[model samples]
Target: MWFTAGLLMAGAVVGNAVLIGQMSGREPVLVLARDVAWGQPVSGDDVKTVDLPVEVGAFAVREVAQAGIVGQVAGRNLHAGDLLAPDDLAAQAVPGPGQWVLGLRLEPGRYPARGLAPNDPIAVHPAPDEGVSSGSGTQQSGQEFPARVVHVSPPDADGAITADVLIPESTAPAAVEAAVGGAQVSLLGPPQK
Candidate 1:
């Protein structure tokens, strides 16, 4: 009877060990507490730590690395509850050297009704000014250039949207010219997969 009791006790100890092992397998990793827009700096309040399985710790940013992540620019738009990965961060802010951020005022027909989001790839097309004769060779039409959406505001009372985009310095002049004459914006897709 003593031998049987010892065996039962040993079994209980082993079972408890297994349970502890499973619990310890999880490690702490940082996740976004709120949505972070691309090119925006991540503040301390934007992140929180959660315990996840060890397998996820391989690619997810560990909680201890939070110091390095804060103040860094986001490489892509990140949603709340997302596991923060290293690739989701950028080395510098938006409009990094040689880039310019421009705000384009778009009407209902000028932009997609589906709406635009940060980090979306877009093309700015120059629209001919009203009363400008299309027959005149001096007018340039159908000139579209690529730009990245930095921020988008809700439609105003007049159904106009304000979109701030990051464009290369070389294209700033053309983009400004287009904005002055009313440009058309087309959403290509998300900037990254």
Candidate 2:
């Protein structure tokens, strides 16, 4: 009887251990850029999941495949390895009333004579028509104003590229006119401190 009782107790202990191990859930890990897709499942294998030191509350994680690591999000810099929660990705640029977002499509090795990148300050100079500025001592006949590059499309052999430009509501008309007339767009670097 003693032997049977001991055997039964050992069996119960082993069973309980196995049951507890199975009940524990896997901890959440940080998703990596390569493993993340718009609707793909996030798992340890898909991203460089790390154990965060602090709790993230009830915020849910999302995989934004189209969003890149740049600019400020809630005044925070986004990096490649950082985890993106729902709230972190909620903020977006809201164009004010009468403001416009313009997209310029350029071919490979063309457009923005001085190379363009996101967040670049630029000036638009329209090429003067023949005989328009022959004696004016000005080769180009258009105004130069400040603008910023919001996005840059990837390069392709087909010369298909796109750039997003942000312009004030008041400047839209003149900018559009200049762009249509083969304006020479020059990207200017940020002012030195």
Question: Number of backbone collisions per candidate, in order?
Answer: 0, 3
* Predicted candidate 2 versus true structure: per-residue lDDT over 65-164, tens digit per residue: 3234222132122345666555443234424366666766655444655567655667765556655655657664667656666666776668656766
Query: lDDT (0-100) at residue 153 of candidate 1?
Result: 92
lDDT of each: 0.89, 0.55
- Regions of candidate 1 where Cα sits further than 4 Å from its true position: 1-15, 134-142, 189-193
Cα lDDT for residue 9, model 1?
A: 100
TM-score of 1: 0.86
Q: Name the lDDT value of residue 70 in candidate 2.
A: 28
